[model samples]
Target: MLSYELFFKEGLYNAEFIKKFTIDFDLLESQVEPYTPEYASMITGLSADDIVTTAREYATSSGSMIAYTLGITEHHCGVNNVFDIANLALLTGNIGKQGTGIMPLRGQNNVQGAGDMGCLPNQLAGGMSLANDEFRARYEKEWGVKLNPYPDDTQTRTFDRLEMGELKALYVIGENPLLADVHMNHTKTLFEKLDLLIVQDIFLTETAQMADVVLPARSWGEVDGTYTNTDRRIQRVRKAVEPHPNTKEDWEILCDLATLMGYPMHYHNSKEIWNEVRKLAWEIYGGITYDRLEEEYSIHYPCPDENHPGTFILHERFHKQNPDIKKSRFVPVDYTEPLELPDPEYPFMLTTGRRYESYNTHSQTRFYAAGIKVKQTEETIDIHPEDACSLGIQDGEMVQVTSRRGELLVKVKITEQVVPGLVFMSFHWSETPTNVLTLNEYDPISGTAEYKACAVAITKVS
Candidate 1:
């Protein structure tokens, strides 16, 4: 809505970069015109003046950055939200330089590493597209095996396939989906329907307990490997302590399983596997060898060759190096209401998030005595005092929270932290099982569940 006023009238945006690199600027302007500050205020509850001020400050600032976490991505319109955020950066040219860009904070330490190593359903190492013929061919030749041209089902779709009896076996590693996934009751049912379930982890989590075969794996402190941090820095992780007598590293377990299944993986150590990765995804991990890391300690990726310096800021010289390659495109997206909204039946909107005291599903943090004693001993719902009064519920009183999918009992903490019509819960306790009350709705493109927003009804337990 303020694009013309800010970009043209006030001259706040980067006109030169936009004209050269970005496409569909005029279309994006038109698309966003309907979404005025007033319209946004009605949805977000922030004043129009505040919105305009924030926009002006963000656009006119010398350097601005936007960092978001799962709160933004765990929504039904998660992809659209990301596209719009990119549109903001593209509009103001808040990218391709120091102290300017969008960053998605990963939930776990190795989440970035996992994605970079092609852990997604439709990606090769270094985030190369599996559908791309050249990328697929390169991997197939290196591994000496035929690669699947088609993309596999996402986790959300895998559950659906399992429920329909299309998928028979599931091999899970380090994930406690029974407590982490939305609609917990449904997830449990789907797991029961699977013909075979194999779980590999350092801890016997709720999901592992149900697995037909459980493989004990070494923890992070006992593993020797490199971790690609959120900043794209590939740093080595050394063994800090000896692993359990029977436990093995995750890679070792996988290799042994593969050997038993007729495909032998003769990787001697983690470094050998890392060498293979450097050979395959040379463009990203090529220059980041273990030897170089031993000297430098850490280095950012896009280190294509041995002599090349590591990249600190991404796309800093992309347009300068290759004028033909447009830096990025503007994707205009409009706001959409959440999949499940508060109604007469479910009068409160419940959002789920993580607490500092406990990690997701309490898989590891539950073992920490300090974390348990310091804060978040158990799961509790946060509700506004007004809502508590209206419902005849007191602070610290046990209450039953129900959603369309399932229900759970949790203690309430009445405070002004949440609005009258909204509540908050952390999904770190298996006893409470917060995901049981969450909706199964997901974004079509990303397949991320609406864990951030769901409709629920809260009442005092009798």
Candidate 2:
């Protein structure tokens, strides 16, 4: 994570390298590994002794940088998933190696940039903590705007207020919240009550269809910009096509909107925007330019100059005392049961995710030379083999999935990809619309909805 400004607290981050509690081998009755058996057997229904033995075996295994994406996160206990991985990294002390580190993959190409720019609820632009007066002062000095000292930059509340009809207007850009977000009905209900809804997109999306104003926008191909990938790669995107005459690139689009909103937004080109982002938040992202990026296809950000070789592995000296002092936090976890466990009425816990073929949602890929058809939509309720046999259902058979939020008819894909107690489906579904079945409950800290866990019942249909 390239941050132009923010820094981490030290002692908060440490491996069990330093002794804390007295270790009693006699008292060490239980052994646990992360994700696997040593997994929290108490809460996760895993075998404690078995996982401990297996974790011993797992520790001996070696490989390249272990990178995990949404497969690890997007869970009821997503934070634990990260905590465990970080612990595993600290155990082996996999810092400052060429092909080592706990690589928690990101959801988007520009997620790092967004993180740097402080799109999060808690931080300010340039990675400054919203609570820190010093960080706020730095931004105030740079922008010359009397920014609010209070720490209240909550997008979760903005969406929540929109749902409650407390917020009259909502502007969304390059994102399809309808299919992309969990609890589809709740979002629709809230958006329905809104006096005005604005959606800016390269293509007409399901969310755009419901918007009061759908502003056409240029795609990455028709735009010149820089996208920082999960690996902190700073790459350039050139304009391969014209900005569709009517639609403009994101930078121009933002500037025009800001100008109309009485903010003096000005930028001649994409390079200028990058320069501004660098200027505002120089600690993490310093003296870097398109000309420097053009020298190579991509290089990691924080390179700071044309002369610097990129840093792929971070935190060798940084994580230690009196150095960079940026040790990754090791948060020991206590597992909690998912909100909705399997019951008689709702006999299965439903979880949602993305498929390799589809991107965010179906709208982009649904229409082909043939047409958009329900059968073309590849969403299926992933049922365990035992569950399918017990429910008297076969693979490819249609099933009625009912959840607390709503219900939908979806095909059943009987497989052992997931555990027996849980069922899986992709949020990418539009016709089946998996989000319709998801609950509105979200992570209190991240405001990330618990899209992964909801009570669902599957009955053989059609």
Candidate with top TM-score is: 1
Candidate 1, run of 10 with poorest lDDT: 1-10
Write candidate 1's Cα lDDT for 1-462 as tens digits.
233344444566788878877888887877765566677778888788887888888898988988989988999889988888888888888888888899889998889999888789899877678999987888899888899989888898888789889989999998999999999999999999888999999889999999999999988899999898888888999999988899999888889988899988889899998888888778887888899999999999889889978998897753464667845778877778888999999999999998887888898988886434656689899999899999999878999999999999999998898887889999898889999999988999989999988999987898
* Cα TM-score per model: 0.96, 0.84
Pairs clashing within candidate 2 = 4-284, 32-38, 33-38
Off by over 4 Å in 1: 1-11, 318-322, 370-373
lDDT of 2: 0.69
Candidate 2 lDDT by residue in tens digits, 277-369 = 677656556646677778777877566555676666675453444532433444545456778777899989887877765677866665555
Clashing pairs in 1: none
